[model samples]
Structure formats: C-alpha cells, structure tokens
Target: MLQRPQANEFDSYFTKYVYNVGDKNINQFLRDQEQNIVHLYNTLSEKEAEHRYAPGKWSAKETLGHINDSERIMSYWLLSVARGDQTDLPGYDQETYVNHGDFNKSEVAALIADFQRARQSTLSLLDSISPAAWVRTGVVVHKRVTARTILYIIAGHTEHHMNIIKHYGNRLT
Candidate 1:
C-alpha cells in the first residue's frame, strides 16, 4: 500500500492539498480523478462554463484550465525529482498562466481533451517509477519535495477544483 506522505516530505502549503486527497492508493486516485473531473465538466453548459462566482474570480473553464496546468507542472516536477534531478525547479505564476490560457475562448470539449492528455502523460510517468522512486527527493521552487507527496498533491488539487465547480461556481449545473 502507498502511504500518505509525511509532512516533512513536501512544502507545508502543499500538505493541505495532500490532506484533501482521500485515497492512499495514489496511482488509482489519480486515474479516478481524471474521469470524475471530466464528468463534472461535461455537465456544464458553455454559459455555465463561463460563469464566475464573484468579481475577479476565475470562470469555471478557467478554473479547470488552472487545474490542468497545475497537474502538468506538478507532474513534471515529480518526474524530474523522482529521476534524481537536483536542479531547483521554477515557481509558476498561476495568474499569468490562466490569463494567457484563453480557456474561456475555447470549447469545453477542447479544455477537457487537453486536460485528459496532460493527465495521461502524468500517469505514464508515474507508472514508470518504482516504489523506491516515490521516496526520491528534489528541489522545486525552493522547497524539498518527494514524488509521493506530489501524487497526493495532484489528487488533492483536483478535489479542490471539483469542490469549487460543485459549489462556488453556479453549482456545476
């Protein structure tokens, strides 16, 4: 069984995300989340996809795009770190990425398709690593992190966005 990574295994901020993930079987959790989130996105109309809960909040589509972007970045970090890369990974600006993503202009189908591909890529990388590789540590945005913690973070990050889509952004209806 894959254990929940220890607090010391990742940056403190990321731990909140890891805690949000329910399943300790990180690999399966990642696979499950991809389908679950796409299911939720499929329920939204284009207008609902564009809906923003409050002023300055991201639209539902943008939020999904952000989730996709985050997964890609985190998974890249995990792969690099697990492969024993000691280089300090750069921190990304979420706002900058989202602002430029143009997800609002794209069809929901496109967004979901892109996200699915990114997720599949991540899963492929994860599957290539051995159990020992899950414990490999490296620097990302100045924080010491392990592959195990990144998996939990990915699962939890998806949960976070799902919650917002389900509640905050027009109830995902």
Candidate 2:
C-alpha cells in the first residue's frame, strides 16, 4: 500500500506522468501494466511494429525500446535514493539512446522480451525498498525527487507511451 507522492515531491515537468497513475496500489499497477503492455505489443507483427505514425516519429518497436530504457533508468534512481545515495544522478538523452538502440533491427518478440526482463528487474528492486526509504530524496537533472516520486514517474511514463502506442493502431493498419 504505497502512498502516492505529494505534488511537491517531484519536478513540475513530471506532473503529467504522475497524474496518469490512479489510486491503484503502485506495485500491483506496475505488475498489471507489464502484462498488459506485453499483450498489446504481442498483437503486432514485426512489419506492423516498424510502422511509425508519421515521419520523424519513433516506430512502435523504438517506442517500446524507449519505455524499457526509461524504466531501467528510473528504477536505478529509485534504488539509489532508497539506499541513501547522495550523489546527483545524471539525466540521459532519449534520442541518442534510441538512435543507438537499433530496435528497428530486432524482432518484435525480442523487444518485448527485453521489456519483460527489465520490468521484472524493476519489480524486484521495488520489493527490496524499505518502508522508511520511500520518502528518501535525491537529485536528478537538478530537481529533487523522492523515491516514491520516481516510482510514480516510471508508471506514468509507461502509460504515456502506451497511450501513444495505442494511437498508432489507427495508422498501423
């Protein structure tokens, strides 16, 4: 029964992501999301996965790869803060990461598999966090955030991308 973080717990830029989360138990929500996302992605054929909604946008596979990368980074932030790490974590450039990922070259099933493994690792790390540590704060990209804030961001970020991926349905066919 982890509580939702307060408005002040995270940066204002993250409000959309945090607000995307509902009243559901964070851990359960994450677990359910993992399955739902996998099922959604599994429905797409490899050729379909390569379809971008428009020019200059990410393909479905690249979007999933971005989601996987973001979750891993946020999970690391969660772990670092929960463990009382005082170091200021650096932010990454999503474009650079995605360009280097070469997700377009991989099978859709393989991308989904990578997502599953990354999410499972995130869940395991979440389980290891102590009750008192949820309130632990750390700096990321120069903004102070709590461990719980990072958790909500992770969930919200996925939901944001999921919505985008769903919208691709209209054009993918």
lDDT of each: 0.86, 0.92
Of the candidates shown, which would achieve the greatest lDDT relative to the real structure? 2
**Per-residue lDDT for 1-173 in model 2, tens only?**
99999998988999998889877799999999999999999999888899888999999999999999998999999899899898999999999999999999999999999999999999999879999999999988889999999999999999999999897687875
**Model 2 RMSD vs true structure:** 0.8
Query: Candidate 1: where are CA atoms >4 Å away?
Result: 169-173
Q: How many backbone overlaps does candidate 2 show?
A: 0
How many angstroms is residue 152 displaced in model 2 relative to the true structure, after the best TM-score fit?
A: 0.7
Query: Model 2: runs farther than 4 Å from truth?
Result: none
TM-score of each prediction: 0.94, 0.98
Q: Residue 82 CA error for candidate 1 (Å)?
A: 0.3
Query: Which residue pairs clash within candidate 2?
Result: none
lDDT of 1 by residue, 1-173 (tens): 78988888988989779898765577777788888888988988998899888789899899989988998998888888899999999989999999999989989989999999999998888779899998999998898989888878888988888887788755433
| Poorest lDDT segment (10 consecutive residues) of candidate 1 | 164-173
Best by TM-score: 2
Per candidate, the number of residue pairs that clash is: 0, 0
